[model samples]
Target: MAILSSLRRRSAAISVAAVAGAATVGVCLTVGSASAGTVSGSLYRDPSSAVVRWVAANPGDSRAAVIRDKIASQPQARWFANFNISTAQSEAAAYVGAANAAQQIPVLSVYQITNRDCGGASAGGAPDLNQYQTWVSNFARGLGSQTVLIILETDSLALLTCLNSSEINARNQAISTATRTIKAANPNAKVYLDAGHSTWNSAGETANRLRAAGVQYADGFFSNVSNYNSTSNEANFGRAVISALNGMGLTGKRQVIDTSRNGGASGDWCGDDNTDRRIGMYPTTNTGDNNIDAYLWVKPPGEADGCRYTAGSFQPDLAFSLANGAPNPPNTTPPTTTPPTTTPPTTTPPTTTPPTTTPPTTTPPTTTPPTTPPNTTPPAGDGCYASVAVNQWAGGFTANVTVTAGKSDINGWTVTIALPSGTSVTGTWNAQASGTSGNVQFTNLSYNGRILGRQSTTFGFQGTGTGPGVTATCVG
Candidate 1:
C-alpha cells in the first residue's frame, strides 16, 4: 500500500467515450505533466490532458514540440465527483475499472463539496449537504477493491473561512462520513484530505482542521494542491503540520506534495496573472522526508486558474514554459509518437464529462492506454480567524464581512455585522444584507445558504460611514 506519487489532470474541450466491455473508460480532456520528478510506480495514461490535445490539434507549432515531448505525453490524475450521484458513481467506477485493467494505480480527485469554490472560479456543487452525502456514497462505489489515491474535497478545509457556523458543522459531518464510507467501500483506497498551500493556513491550524475533518482515518494529507509554492517550502510546511498532528497523538500519518507548478514561489497566490511559475519536482514516492510520503503534480501546469483563460482549460504557452524551464528535468523521457504512448495500454480511451462548472470540447483521440485517473489548497488565517476588509471613499464606504464557522457549519444560517450609524448597504454578493448602521442582518443566498465545516464566505456592501476608524464587528 505504498503510493509514492500523485497526479494533476488538465481540462479541455474533450470527449471520453466509454468502450463497452473494455477494461477502461475513455477521458476526452487533454492534460500535460511535469518533465522532472521521481516515480515510485508507473503513471496512468492521459491521452487527453490539455498539453497532449493542443499538440495534437496543432502539430506544426514549433514551441509546443518540447512541451509536447516532455509533458503532454506524461501521465496525470483524472478528477471525479460532481453534482449528480449517478454521474459521479459511473465516472469513478469507469476510471477505476480502467486503472485496474492497466495494473496502474489511479489517482482520484474528489471535489464536489457543496457550494464548492465558495462562489468563485470553480463554483457549483451538490445542492445541499444531504445530496452531497449521497453523491459521495455513490462515488465510493467506484473504488472497487483496488488501491486508489483519493484527494478528498480540494480546498474543503482551507476554505473554511468562507462559511458560517451551520455550514461548518455540516461540512465536518460530511467529511467524517465520506472518509468512513470510502474506506469501507474499498479497504485499499488511500484518502488524503486537501491541506491547501503553505502560504494559506498555518501548520497548527491545518492539523487541527484536518483532525476535525477526520484525517485520522485517512492515508494522510496533501499540500500545494495546484499551487506554485516551492516543494521545499511545502515540505517544511507539511512537516510542521505533520508534527502538529503527531503531537495530537496522530502518528504514522504521511503526506503527499504537489510539485506540479512550484518551479518558483509566488508572493501573490490569489493573483491569477502569475507567470514566473514553472513545473516542479517529478512525481515520485522517494521524497527525502520521512513524514512526507510522495511528491506529485496534483495541479497540472498549463491549466489556467480562471484568470488568463478559461479557469481549467490548457494554455500552450504556459505549458511550454513549464516544460522547457523545469529546474530539475525528469529522469525518464516520453515517446515521440503522434500521441505519445511510452507504455502501450490495453484498455480503450474513456470519454469523460468535465467537472460541472464548465463543459469540455475536443475532437478525437488517436489512441490511449487504459490507466488510472486524477486531481486545491488552503488560505492564511489570523488570530480572530474572522475579519473583513473595508474601503472608504469620500462620501461613501464599502464593507465586507467574512464569518467563520468556528467549529460547525451555518445551516439555514444568518450573519449580522455591525455598521456605523448613517451607514446604508448599496449592494452585495453571495448573501442578502438589510437594516442600517448598528444592525445589518446579512442572510444567506439560496446558492450559498449552507457553509461547510471550518469554512468561511464573505458578503459586502457600499455605505456612508465615518472614515478610517469606522470599525465593524461581524457575527454568524
Candidate 2:
C-alpha cells in the first residue's frame, strides 16, 4: 500500500523505506505517526495470553526472551466467542470485570454466527438461533457500559453462498438478534461486523451482505481479519464497501482493518511460513483517514492461521518475527478510492517435468511450538505441487493443496486440477478459485501471492469431489 505524505514532511519520506515489508506493498510506504500496543483509553494491559502463561512456565528457553520482549509484552485480544457453553457467561464476566477493574475499554472477538465456520477448520457455533441468543445474552451481560470494540464475527457474510435461503435467513436473524442484545446490554460498545476482505467480495456485494446481517445496529464493518491482505488493499476495499453501504442510504459508517500481521503483504493467505510478515500500523484513533477508526491487531501476532500449526495456536518464533519485523508507525496506507484487482483466468509460467532423482527446494519451516501445541510439519512436496481429495460425502469433499517455488522466489501460482465428470468447486478458504471447463483453477490471495525461494503456501476448496482418482497440474 502507498502512504500519501505531504512532500514537505522529510522524515516520513525517508522513513517510507524503513518499513520492514515496504517492497511487498503495492502502495509505497508514506505515513504519519501512530501509537503502539492496545487502543488508547484501554483500561489496562492486555489480559494474560497463552504466550504469557508459557513464558511464566518456560522462562529458561532461549525463545522466552523474544516471547517476553515481543509477543507476551504487548496488548492484544481475548476471544470469548469460542464454543464453551458451560463457561461462556463466567468467562465473559471475568474478562469485562478485569477490564473494568483496570478502567480500560476491552476488545473482544465474538464469533456468533449459528453455523460459525462452514465446517472448515474453526467450525461450530450455537446449534440454532434460539441457543445463539441465549449464548449472546450471557456474553453481553458482562459489558455493562464499559467502552469496548466488538468484532462480531470473522466470516459471517461469507457463509451466504454455502447456505440455502432458510439457513441464510436464520443466520441473519441470529446476527441481528445478537447485535441488539449486545447493544441493549451496553449502548456505548463500538460494534463492527465482518466484510471478509478486499479480495473476497465486491463492494456492493459486501455492503448488501452486511446490511442483510444487520449493519444498522453496528458501528461499521471490518476487513482482512485473520488473513494477510495488504493494508492498502483492505483500506480501499473497506472504503468501497462503505461507499456501497452509504449508497444504499446508510450514513456515517466507518471501518476497522486488521493490522496484526500485514506488515508485509506477500498475499500468502494459505501458507504457514510468515517470516515475510511485518508489523502494521499500531492500534490508534488518529488514523489519517477518518473513515477508518483504527488499524488493529485483530488476529494477534504469533497465532497460527491453521496452516502453520493448529489453527489459532500462538507461536513464539512467529510472534518474535512479527514484533521484530514490524516498523513503527509512521506506517503505510493504501488509497481510499483504489479499485480491487479483478479475479479472472490469467497466464502463469509453465510447469516442468521432474526426474525421479532431483529434489526441489524445501518448503520453509513453520515456527517453534506455540502456547498450544503446534503441528510444524509442512506438507512434503516439490516445486509447484498440488494435492486433492474426494472425501466429504457421496458428492462433496475437501481439497487441500500446496505450492513451492522451483529455483527462485515466486510471485504467483496457478493450480488446475481436473475433476471427475460431475464435480465442481462449491467453496474455498485461504485462497480464491473457480470451477469451469471441467476443472477448478485455484490461485493465491493478494497477501500470499509472492513466496520466497523454497518457501511455500497452500490453498483449498470444498466441492463435489466425484472422482475415484484426482490429479494436480501446477504453474508458478
Candidate 3:
C-alpha cells in the first residue's frame, strides 16, 4: 500500500428536489487525508453562568469525571474565552491570566463592539468607531506567553448590504485597528479576519472585501467561521480566496478555517435540517501551504448559533448527533484498497516461414511454437511477496516475509491504504485495529531481521476500497 492521499469534494449547492427526482445519483465525495495536529476547545464559556450550570447538573454525577478527563486529555484543544469584557483593560488582564495558567493557546472571539446579532437575524456593530477601538485595545492587552487566535467580529465584514460606505469603512477601520493593537500587544498572536463561508461569498467578492478591509494588516483571513459546509468545499473556497488575496498583492499569507459543525455540507443556507451540522477535523499544525494554515474546530460541535433549538444554548444531544452520535448517522464509506490493473503480454510469430520447396527435400517437417519470456514483476491480484499492499484488509492488515542474503528486505515497512468505498475494516492483527464512530486505527506490528543484500520482505492486507474519485495533491 502507498501513502493515502487526500481527497477533496467541492460542495456545490444542489436542489434537494432535483436530486431526489433523479433516477440515479452520482455522489462525488472526497475523504480528508489523515493529518498530524490537534485543536481542542469549547465554543464559549460564561464563567459565572456556565460554572453554576455545570455544578448544578453534575452533582455526584460520574459523567463529570468523564467529561473532565476527556477535555483534559486533549491538550491541543484551546479554551476559548468568549464573553463581553466591559472594559478593555479588564478583559486584557483576564485573558492574560487565563493564558498564563493554561500553558495552552487561547482562542478568543472579539464580539462586544458589534451588534452581536443579539436581537435580530442580522445585527449591526458599534455606531461609534472610537468605542470599538477602545474595546479592541483592551482586548489586545490580555496576551501572555500563550498565543491567541482571534476570530475578529464574525460577519461584520459580511453583512455589507445593511451598512453604508461610511459604516462599512468604520467597520474596516475597527478591524484593522484591532488587528494592529493585538499584534503590538502580542507579536506571536495569530489573527484571522473572518470570511463567512463559501455559500455566503463568491471568491472575487470576498477578495475585494478582504482587501478593502485591510486584510494585509491581519495575519490572514478565515472562512466557514460558523457555518456547516464540508471541509472539502471550505478548503476549495479557501484556496480561491488565497488566490484572490494574492491577486491583490498580499502573497504568502495563510488562512485558517472553522471545521467545527460541518461533518457534511449543509443542504440549504438557513433553516434546513441538514444545516444543523456536526464537527470533523480539529485544529491542526500549520499546513505549510502558503495560503492555508489549519483546519480548526472553532465552533464546538453541537452548540447552537441561535438556531432556535434552545436559544443560544449548547444541546448535547444535537452536538452528539452531529458528531455522529444519534439522529444524524455517520458516513460509513469504506476506505479505498483496490490495486491498479495490469495488461496482458502480447505474442508474435517469426517474419518468414520455411519455403514449401524445402518440404520436398525433407522427409518430415517439425514445427515448434515460440516460448514467451517469464514476467519478473509481480502480476496484478497475485499479492506477491515482493510488493504487498498493507491496507487491503478491512480494518488493517500486516504480514511478514523473509529475505535471503544479498537481498534487501522491505520489512519494517508500513503501508496505510484507504479502505474502498462502502466497506470498512472490521478487525486487524499483529496489533489491534479498532473502528469506532467512523475513525479507524492500526498499530503494533513486528518486522525483524535484515534481508540479504538484495532480498526484500513484504506485508499487506486486503480490506475494503472506496471512491471513484482520484487523490488530491497540494498544488504548491
Candidate 4:
C-alpha cells in the first residue's frame, strides 16, 4: 500500500540541496501564483501539512516534485476530527495562534458531531450532544478574535436520513448551540454549516435542513465537502438554496463551495480508489461571484477517503495522481495597466500622521476576466462608494475594504484610504496596492475592477499597527 511506502520514507533525513532545487524548479514548473480565476493568494498555508511532511521526508521520491508544488503549497482547512475534550482548547489555540502570527485567515474544520459518518468507516465522535456542546465551547476558547473560517461538522446535516425524528431534532439543536457558542467566543470567526453536495439534496430541501440546523446564526453554508462535484453545479445549487432561504425570510445568507477533488468528474463517487479525479479551483475568497463567498479546499487533496488507505491518512501516490490529473494552471498574465502611478501627497495627511515607509513587495495583477459585467448605465449620484471594516490585535490589524458601484456599473475604480498614525500596510489581496504608510492607494485588478450596479466587491490588507480611525473613499 502507498501508506507503507510513505511510512518507510518518514524518518529519512533529506539534504539541503535537494530541498532548494525541488522548491525552486517544482513550483516554477507546475504551479504559478494563486492569483488567477478562483484561487486567492491571501489565505494561510499550513507549513507542517501532511503533504509537506511527506515531501520533506521523501525529497528523492519520484512523485515528490508535483506533490510539493501542487498539494503542499496550497491552503486547505485543518480538520479537528478527534474527540479530545481535555486538549481541544490548547490545540485550537496553537493552530489559530500560528495563523494570527502570520497575519492570514485560518480555515478550520470541526468534525466532532455526536454520530459522525453514521457509524461508517469514519465513525466515532463526542459521546453525546451535551459532551459535544462542551467540546465546542472548549475549542471556541482558542479562536482568539482573529479572522477565521470554521467549517462545522461535515455530514451532520446531510446524513440525517439515518437518524430518527427525535435524534434529528437533538442534532439540529446541538448544531444551533454550537454555532452561537463559537460566534460568541470569537466574533471574527466565520462559521459555515455543511449542506452536502449539489447532487445529494434538492436546493429547497437543503435550505430547509440548513435552517432547521440554525443557518440563521451562521455566516453561511458550505457544500461539497469530501465529495467530487463541479464548482458550477455546487455554486448554482448554493444560489438556489440562498433563494430558498430568502423565501423563508432568511435573507443575506452567503455560501462557500469546496472545490477540492472536484476538478474532474462530478459524480456520487466517494471512498473510491479512482485516479480520474483532479483538484478543483485553488482556495480563494475573491471568487468574483457575489453569491459565492469563497472556493475552499475543505478536504485536503492528498488524504484518502477510507479507500485504498485508512481514512484521513496521506497517500503520496493518490496525491501525485490528483496533481498529475489537474487542468493546466490558470494563465497569470498581468493586466495591461500598471500598478497605481499616482504620486503620494507631499503635505501632511488630514486624519493621521505618517509612519515609517515600509512598502510591501509588488505583485503583478492577474488578467483573468471579470465574472460579472459592469452596468453600463450612468449613476444618478456618485459613481461609487467605499467602506472600511477593521479588525485589530495587539500590534497588527486587518481591514476589509468594500467598493460599491452606485446605481450603475463601473468600468474601473481607485480607492484611497487614510489610516491612523503608527499603522503601515504590509500585505494585500484581491487588489493591487501602492503606498504602505498613512494614506495608501488601492486599485482594482483586471478581474475585479468591474462590478454591477449597487453591488459591492471586497479587498483586504494587513497592517503593522492599529488603524482605528481609517477612512476610505472610492472614485470610479
Q: What is candidate 2's lDDT per residue for 143-220, written digit by digit as tens? A: 768778888877677434356644554465467557867998898888888886775556766776776666777888
Residue lDDT tens for model 4, 1-476: 01111111000001111111112222211122343232243577665555655676676899987786667667777777667789889888988997888677788888788776666544567887656877898999999998788998876776654575446645765786789789999988889997877765667777767876777779889988745678998889998989988887677788888887777863324423667788888777777787777788777776655435554556788888789856544433311211112221111100101111221122111111112222233335758877665544456555656688888789899988887788898777667889998788899988678888897666667677775343567899
Over the stretch 1-476, how does candidate 1's per-residue lDDT look in tens digits? 11111222112222223222212121222122322222244556555444555666565677666775556655566665346666777777877887788676677777777876565555666777656766887888878997777878777776654676445545754676688779989998888897766766667777767765667778789887745667888888888988888887777677888877777664344214556667777665556567666666666667655545655556677677667866434544333443433332221111111222221121111111111111011223321123454433345544445555545555655655656566666555456767665666777677655666676554445555542132333344
- 2 or 4: which has the higher lDDT? 4
Instruction: TM-score each candidate.
Output: 0.62, 0.59, 0.52, 0.62
Candidate 3 residues 1-476, lDDT tens each? Answer: 11111111111101011011111111111222332223222222212222123323443544433222221111122222233436556655564565556354555655544543322332334434544554565667766545566776665564454454334544554565578678888887778786767766566666666765557768778776546667778778888888877775676656777765566654543222344444555444444454565666554443343334533344444443454432211133422221112211111000101111100111100111111222134323312223221211122222221112222323333223333456554333232344521233333244323333444332212233421111111100
Question: Quick one: best TM-score, which candidate?
Answer: 1
Alpha carbon lDDT of residue 290, candidate 3? 47
Query: Candidate 2 clash total?
Result: 18
lDDT for position 115 in model 4:
73
Q: Give all candidates' CA lDDT scores.
A: 0.58, 0.57, 0.43, 0.66
TM-score of 3: 0.52
Name model 3 segments beyond 4 Å from true: 1-56, 59-86, 115-119, 122-127, 266-276, 286-290, 326-476
The true-versus-predicted C-alpha distance at residue 179 of model 1, in Å, is 1.0
